[model samples]
Target: MIWEKLKEWMGGGEDGNGEFQPEWITLLEKNLPLYKRLPDEMRQHLHERIARFVESVRFEGCNGLDVTDDMILTVAAQACLLVIHRDGVPYPGLRTVYLYPSTFSSIHKSVDAMGVVTEGRVHRLGESWETGTIILSWDSVEQGARDIRDGSNVTFHEFAHQLDHEDGPTDGAPGLASRAAYRSWARVFSESYADFQELTERGRKTVMDAYGATSPAEFFAVATETFFEKPRQLSGKQPELYEELVGYYGLDPREWLP
Candidate 1:
């Protein structure tokens, strides 16, 4: 909550005069539009967040791609947005972010109880690890930034997973402020997750992505992407889920809704 704010006030990322850097502001303006739409105070928080994140985490380009300040700020700013109105260090366990020029491939293998091993290769846009490693496709990150209302963001989606992993298992539920809050989270998310799961399975058009049915973890990540990107549509189509997300995030994106 105020921990990050206090740290910034104590000169965590502020300049000698305790001001947000002009260079950082220029990078944000040139790279991401949604950051520009933030309210002034929230924007300042995001600025401090980006500064700390850029300093804390390692941003390495893979496959011959060169990561730039624009790329770093774009990702850091969006990740910090999730915490702008909430608590704790942003990505407390995270240490590294790997950026790829485009979608990357990974091998998926599973063994069934019948002693059968299945293997497949899947192309991915973003992925997060319990070891605090985050991988992303630069292409999707830029695309999400270019069009902010698409209800899809690789960076946001993956970082939400990081939050899910914070308390313990990668279950859809995150660590709430209290026991009552946890109960509310469990009830609302369980009901909505089931309903959304059924809606997707029935091949009906839904506001949330069908991929969310993959698991509760995926559902939470997808919910996060929709909560910020397509706030109006999500609020209209899934008011209950919207309220749940609003409660959890402590920020209402309807002000930036298009």
Candidate 2:
């Protein structure tokens, strides 16, 4: 409880009024690869927002992991990219991000019908919620960046959840720009998610990770990872869903990748 309070204080509390420093911009330019991929217009926009995001969020080194400026900028850039594609929408409610050296364990309380509280153990590399906190394991974040394949990216996964939660709960639908787009998003995503679920249940070979079959929310998150990591494959196999995401994100990553 005390730790949470201190972190809140360091993170600038509910109203994040932290100052953005010039040094952080230089550090981000020197480190993040994704920054180089951005167009001049997008890069300028990202730079300003990312600087503010880094200031508002608190990062702590744990388990001997070094919380370098590069790591923080990289994670922030990736998270902030989702917002850059869409204008006028803020980060919603998220405030702080907790960093760990590796996968961490947490005891979650669950109440049964009798109102008896039970502790459930959870081991995760990253997690994000509507309440505005993101947790990550640095080791996993590094590995995910090193190799975008294998269909596992802790930063992207967690940040995608953050995007989904911006409007409300993550029901695989991040709020679309228009009612027409929202209708199209629902139709395309629903069809693709159902198809993927069936294929996974039948033990068929799937291009994307099977974890995506767990839920509609997971499907969107996993698809976002593949959208950035392996765009060509995703576009070729799931053209409809790919087009939907391209329309939604407002950027075509396939143009960036070789």
Q: Write down the RMSD of all candidates, one decimal each.
A: 3.9, 6.6
- The Cα error of candidate 1 at residue 255, in Å, is 1.6
Candidate 2 clashing pairs? 94-132
- Name the regions of candidate 1 deviating beyond 4 angstroms: 1-16, 86-88, 112-115
lDDT of 2 by residue, 143-205 (tens): 786565565777888988888987777899997889999899999999999999999999998
**Candidate 1 clash total?**
1
lDDT of 1 at 210: 88
TM-score of 1: 0.90
Which numbered prediction scores highest in lDDT against the true structure? Answer: 1
For 136-223, candidate 1 gives per-residue lDDT tens digits of 9999998887688778888889999998989999999987899998888888889888999888888999877889988999999999
